[model samples]
Target: MKIFNLFIFLFFVTTLSNAQEAKQDFYKRSFIAYEGCEDSKDLERCYEISFHEFLAKHINRKALKDSIFFEAKKDTITVSASILYDENGKVVKRHSRISNPASNRIEGLEYLLDSIPTVKPVLDKKNNGVALSTRKLFGFYLNKAKDTIVPIFGYTPSEVPYEIIEKVPVYKGCDESMSNEDLKNCMNDKVVQLISENFRTNLAIKHNLKPGIQRIYVMFKIDKKGRVKDIVARGPHPEIEKEAIRVIKKIPRLKKPGYQRGKPVIVPFSIPIVFAVSD
Candidate 1:
């Protein structure tokens, strides 16, 4: 298996506001008045960054350690949520659906939401605080090795690129004591080898794909714990894509997670796999 350039888009519904005037001009749209973002030149981006930072800091990670959401070797948890603010800029209502129904009633989440501070609501052209309703996508990565739950906020949260991260994730069997460059090379080689060994090439013939090179774009995140999560793939055929995901998911947990500036960070990766089909 040969690996090539990769790109990842953390697709999620970040902003779903009911402000009617926003349709007129996107750049002029009013953003929620998160503290310290009121004077930002780019208000929307600032709000997103500030909001994600708040969640990551205040979400009470330790309380989630024993939650059912992280059970059964689960590496990622996602939530589809709506937060409503009254004209007074208070969080009056909040609704969320977790990825796992078994953990539907999350106490940690309830406490976190309750702790959210009342920010200045987004104002309309009239300069009046407008009642607001917005939907958000939230996620959490389980670092099993450290027994920690890292909160992931907003759509497309900042993820360190592979080439730039201080230390790339090491595969389970790779020698971790090696230099960073060697470790990265070893990890990439291990990934290619794992995919080639596990991927079901016969699926291509079954799907009757054309007798040529078929490219499957695989995207995933290697979390702080070095576990594979959020695997997504696009290919010529649905079955082919499914097989690609299966092969990637089968990868064993890595020995070490990537680090940046002395702290572990989530790393996003995408790989182009060339699958050949035969008549």
Candidate 2:
């Protein structure tokens, strides 16, 4: 069935090249932390990078208690996930959910213990910035699935279609549901669409891509100013990788920038985008 080339390679460039870029050269390194095309979390990381602001735009919890909560609890912190591939590791579909336990930590910090009546607090935020629950929960993993070589285009690799598998979950995190102000502020520009298009066109032109299927993973940042700042990739591919990076570099700033208690800050990105042959 031709496998419908939904090409989304992660990132793979030397550290030396990245260190040489300018602060303004943010888009150039859009997907670095997410190299090696490890798993679905990598893709989710790319989404986090490319659309952090957009996603953050989605997170609005009226009360911390009512923040996005998971349906089930796990001994460790990892969303249930699955990778669809052949017997080898040639990836077909990489699927996963978002996860982070940092937000889940509430009971262990010593400073907050005094707030409770029954017990004398033994912990200290300075000494124990984390809760005991936080101690056991690890919300992320660094490419647990490691491999040196990968199947390049028309070649076969050792892990071709290996069905790389894991049992993470569809856990939900804090909600960033949009507000009237958020909708109004963002609608004037429809920033995500513009960014997506800019990258798409850049890929088609600069990369000399045709009407065939291509996969790409895009990464970028939404600084506190709401501007999409730094971007990089984490894995590799053929010409598609080059074009994907080029496209992300062209997106204009969305909102001026976001703020945390009224200050501009730099957020990082590690998102992935996919390109498929158009009909």
Candidate 2: tens digits of C-alpha lDDT, residues 35-69: 22334344434423332322222322321123223
| Per-residue lDDT of model 1, residues 157-254, tens digit only | 23455644556678888898876666766777777887767776666656666665668888899898889999999999898789889888988988
Q: What lDDT does each candidate get?
A: 0.63, 0.30
Task: Please give the distance, in angstroms, between residue 166's alpha carbon in candidate 1 and its true position after superposition.
Answer: 0.7
TM-score, predicted candidate 1 vs. hidden true structure: 0.44
In model 1, which regions exceed 4 Å deviation? Answer: 1-158
Q: Name the lDDT value of residue 218 in candidate 2.
A: 60
TM-scores for every candidate against the unseen true structure:
0.44, 0.30
- Which has the greatest lDDT? 1
Cα-based lDDT at residue 262, candidate 1 = 62
Error of 2 at 132 (Å): 24
